[model samples]
Target: MSMTLALRRSIQTTPEQTATVFHGRRQSFCRFGDRVARLASALRTQGMGSGDRVGMLGVNSDRWLEVMMGVWWGGGVLNPVNTRWSGPEIVYSLDDSDTGILLVDDHFLHQVEGIRTTARRPPLLIHVGEQAVPEGMLSLEALMAASAPMDDAHRAGSDLACILYTGGTTGFPKGVMHSHGTLWAIGIQRLAQTPMPGGSVALHVAPLFHMGGMGRALVQFIAGETHVLLSSFDAREVMQTIERERVSDLLLVPTMLQALITHPEFDCFDLSSLRRMVYGTSPIAEAVLERALDLLPHVAFTHSYGLTELGSATTNPPHNHGAQGRASGLSRSAGRANAGLAVKVVNGDGVELPRGEVGELVVAGPNLMLGYWNKPQETAQALRGGWLYTGDGAHMDGDGYVFIVDRLKDMIVSGGENVYSAEVENVIARHPGVMSCAVIGVPHPQWGEAVHAVVVRKPGAALEAPDLHAHCKAFIAGYKCPKSIEFREALPLSAAGKVLKRELRAPHWAGQSRQVG
Candidate 1:
């Protein structure tokens, strides 16, 4: 079934149930459904047609969820702009996808002017700000109030649903296309693995733009549970919100969890309502996990492993967690293949490797994405012979558990966010003072891994770390900028003259059990 129809069930069966709670502003399913319908009607009036792209650039809120369903209900494709991306990067996605309409919250409204100037086709803007509507934009609240609720477009299964952009190897971003069926399958499969609590209060602290947050939201919606949302992740606010809302289920990255559990006031809050915590985006450190387990003994921690191309591929179930499971080394595994999906570690030639041998992890199932949008060659290369070649080096145990050894792709995940070294290198290479650069993820105490850059300065150039860091931030998101930088005379290079990132990463990662953090 399609996401639109799935949402309809909640509205029809539990219309009076609390659908969304954002900073104490709660809305019933009936009201939420009406707003979604009216928003859909308004989108259609603004020239959104079947499969037209509608970009949403905002923080996590009830309105964000409303716009997501509203876009699909109006028979449009969703393009959730990365909240961390700079204006130019955001503009590139809008232009690349040919988006005609955009939804912006008060937090990101400042970037609209820059996006409008750079984009090929300036989008029709809808301001979702808490304050009054800004100049040169339509107010989302006004549009919903003025428009009449319309019938659903009945778009389901195989219909173009979302175009989620991911960092590319060639300095640009690639849009990963997913159908309604793909997303729905992912949510349903996850539910099969670990069911949500009855009348669960699911908290939404992760950015709604990311697949992790949106995917979790999808599952919560299907279960017809209440969604408590915060605009963004703040350690203090998260603890406070959990106490006030009595949040039962939570989706967070390891970094966010670290921040929350380590906060000085963490123990002061009555977080007894928390029953489930789903974490992913990067591997959590053993120490961090142990500390979390000790602090919240009642909460079941589940680790998920997946990519934008394949949603919810593997999940380390809660039973394999805690002190007992950690001692057995079961906590290191990425878990067995998810429900109804086939996962195998295969060699470069596409042959399945032995269970204990590390190889490229490939996944095949209905949950896989359609492909990279408009990039046929890249799509074909990624989806070879019906298997999605996940660029992750992994091995399966006799028990069917998968353990990721290294990243086949030069990617780094820091603070629970994917940071492509190539993308960062591209920005660094542009600096006039930089002769050469190699970016890698290094072991970090707090963030799990920090973006570390090794740069070779030009002859007679006196470049500092702060200089390069600021330069990168001017183009990409701040999180992508190198947290630590080293000026090297020259980087380790292979016989082919390629920078040997593995050698660069070795000293920092020595003694670590897994190559990845």
Candidate 2:
């Protein structure tokens, strides 16, 4: 079934129920459906065609969700831009996807000029913020008001839904494409694993551009629950929203969870309304988990594990976080495969490994992405023999619990964002003073892992950390830039002359039980 089916059902069954809450604004299912229809009509009038790609570059808000549904309602594809990326990076995605219409918020107005100058064909700009409409750009409200409500296009099954960009090992980002069928499968699998309570209200803290955030939002919509949105993650604001809205559900990463539970005025707010939380994208520190379990004894905690290529393959239920499960060490597992999904560890030759033997994790399910956009070779490498190679080194116990040990790919998860080491190293190696460099993820207190760089300087060159920092800032996002830098005369290398990143990362992860945070 198409995702729009959820909205259609909500409008038919509970038109007066609250659909979205953003800041002080609230919209009922009836009103929300009307706005979505109008927006879809506006998009069609603006020349959006069936299967065309439309991009939304903004923070999380009611309008963001509206645009997402409207695009599909109008029979168009969605390409949600990464809010943290630099101008060039954003341009690359827009150009790569051939997005013809782009929506911008107040927070991203500064990027418009860069996009216009650099993009192959600059998209038609529509201002979605509360600020005064910019010259030569159309106002979203005006367009919606001018257009009449339109019918749902009923796009479903193999029809493309979204193109989500993920960091690449080739110093570029690749677009991961998903169809309506795949997304519908993910929602069904999630619901079958852990059902949402009736009248559950979910507060979104993670960016809507992320799979973790968007995937959970899909599940909530499928369950016909109320949504409360925050433009970004703010500990105090999250606490206030939960208390005021009586939010019962949340989807947060380890970093956001830590910030919320460790806030100075954490106890000042009445957060008793929250009942269930799902955390993923990075491993949680044992100390933080213990503290949270103690502080929020009534809340059920679940851990999820998945990737953009394959949405939500496994979910550790709340029972695994309790005292009994902790004593049995089940808390460390990423849980078994969700309903209708299959996960297995395999050797290098695609042969299944024995249970308890560490190997690459592969998943097979209806939730697997169609493929990477415009990259047939990469898609083949990722999806082979009806299985998606996850690039995660893991082992499954006899009971089917999967434990992640390391990343087979040169990638890092810091503050719930994926950073490719090759992408960062590419930016650093561009510095004329740097002879060689390697990027690795180091243990971090707040971000779970931090991007760290080790550089070998050119003889007689005065390359400092500040110089490299400034250089990287020009090409990549701030989070992808190195949090710390160290200089060495020579880097440890193998016989093949490849830098041994394991040695460099070992010092920083000395006491960590696993290579990943």
The candidate maximizing TM-score is 2
| lDDT tens readout by residue for model 1, 244-282 | 989999988888888988999987999999999988888
Regions of candidate 1 where Cα sits further than 4 Å from its true position: 515-517
lDDT for predicted candidate 1 compared with the true structure: 0.90
Q: After superposition, how far is residue 111 of candidate 1 from its true place, in Å?
A: 0.5
Q: Which stretches of candidate 2 lie over 4 Å from their true place?
A: 515-517
Q: What's the lDDT for all of these models?
A: 0.90, 0.93
